[model samples]
Target: MKKIIYLLILTLFYSCTVKYYGYVYDIDKKTPICNVRIKTIDSLNITYSNENGCFEIKLKEKVKELVFEKENYQAHNLRTLSIQSGEFMKELPFGDTIYLISKNSKYSRPKTTLPNNVYKK
Candidate 1:
């Protein structure tokens, strides 16, 4: 009886945690973006993409939101619920591809020429 109860508890604990695997990429370039930060919005769980842009994060089932960030790129927010709503791919083992938009592409300004007199030391 004790062994049965222990097994049940172990199964419940294991089922409470979920692992999400995916790769990050540049939206415009269609190339992998390495070192992107992935974190749970409501928890301390965090991980980073590798040189190949592959990453895996283990989060509690209760965590509904994820935030992805990187330098010079726009931050992306993903809701777990969207996956169930068919907004995101349902595949797990094969993983998903997350695209990030470069900040420069979104907010580029025209260059202005400066006067030569301003170059005086």
Candidate 2:
């Protein structure tokens, strides 16, 4: 009975271990975006991107979805995130560079005044 219980406990512990992994990048610039805030969709377990725009969060819950947010950037959802697996006891690379679109990058075209309009011709 003791061995059975121990096996069950070990299985449960390993099964719940999850590593949230990804890199954040600027959608337009095509460069890594650092210091981006990443968290579970429910607002739990927050983490930030490193200088290389890489991040890994170890989680006990089964949160497969996350949101990346930053100032002057649009919030992004990594909805296609995968389920937790493996038992190497460490974070692993998942997929894709998470992209964030900057709100401050909006471009407004300058109005061009013709020479004829200035002379009132």
Candidate 3:
């Protein structure tokens, strides 16, 4: 009976894993970015940030890298993240935020451009 109980406890302890919550923010504005896309580097798994710029992704086996992107923001490729799985509810440092650069001009001009000579007098 002791041997059976020990085996069950060990199996339960080693079988635990957790999905982490991630957040996306604008690097320059320091604000949350909504509707952002998130994907794994080595797999087809993909997820998106909600209105609050937060997302949760389950690590596929041992994948530790994710790529984030949105329409106007430059894609933020997160590589080589330090992963600590098996914790039921571990608190992550400020490292959960992924910063992204804007693809638009510094002036935040509209992405559209008029055809040549359209602005000609």
Candidate 4:
């Protein structure tokens, strides 16, 4: 009985997660950007990049934006994010894939050209 309880506890702890992954880039270098700060628009949750320019955060519902910032790189705001996975919402998944690019102190990123219903005024 003790062994079984121990196994159950281990499984429960290992099965939990609280973050999603994201990619960052530099437009001029056309390369993966490292050391950038990424956070929820609410300024509550935040994270930074790994060597591969990837990051993760576990956020609950009600998050409105994901902000990115770096020195020598303009700040970028990504809005209208919806993590509508239904049963899969707890899987710690990423939203729309974004490629942030910057040039001459300006920034641009690829987003769904089509209109998004999540847009807010």
Best by lDDT: 1
Q: After best superposition, candidate 1 residue 111: deviation in angstroms?
A: 18
Better of 1 and 3 by TM-score: 1
TM-score of each: 0.65, 0.62, 0.59, 0.56
For candidate 1, give the lDDT of residue 20. Answer: 83
List model 3 lDDT by residue over 1-121, tens digit each: 9999999999876666446577888877888988888887754888888888898876535455678879977776765446356544434443478878787637344558779999898
After superposing candidate 1, which stretches have Cα over 4 Å from the reference?
Answer: 1-12, 82-94, 106-121
How many residue pairs of model 1 clash at the backbone? 0
Worst 10 residues of 4 by lDDT: 87-96
**What would you estimate as the lDDT of candidate 3?**
0.72
Query: What local distance difference test score does each model get?
Result: 0.81, 0.77, 0.72, 0.68
Q: Which scores better on TM-score, 2 or 3?
A: 2
Cα displacement (Å) at residue 32, model 3: 1.0
State the lDDT of candidate 2 residue by residue for 45-87, as single tens digits. 8999998999887788655467888987878777533445654
* Backbone collisions counted per model: 0, 0, 0, 4
Could you tell me which 10 consecutive residues in candidate 3 have the lowest summed lDDT? 86-95
RMSD of each: 9.0, 11.1, 9.6, 8.3
The TM-score obtained by model 1 is 0.65
TM-score of 4: 0.56
Model 4 per-residue lDDT tens digits across residues 1-121: 9999999999877667445676786766667788888888778888887777777777655455678888867688865345575533323346434556564534553444756765866
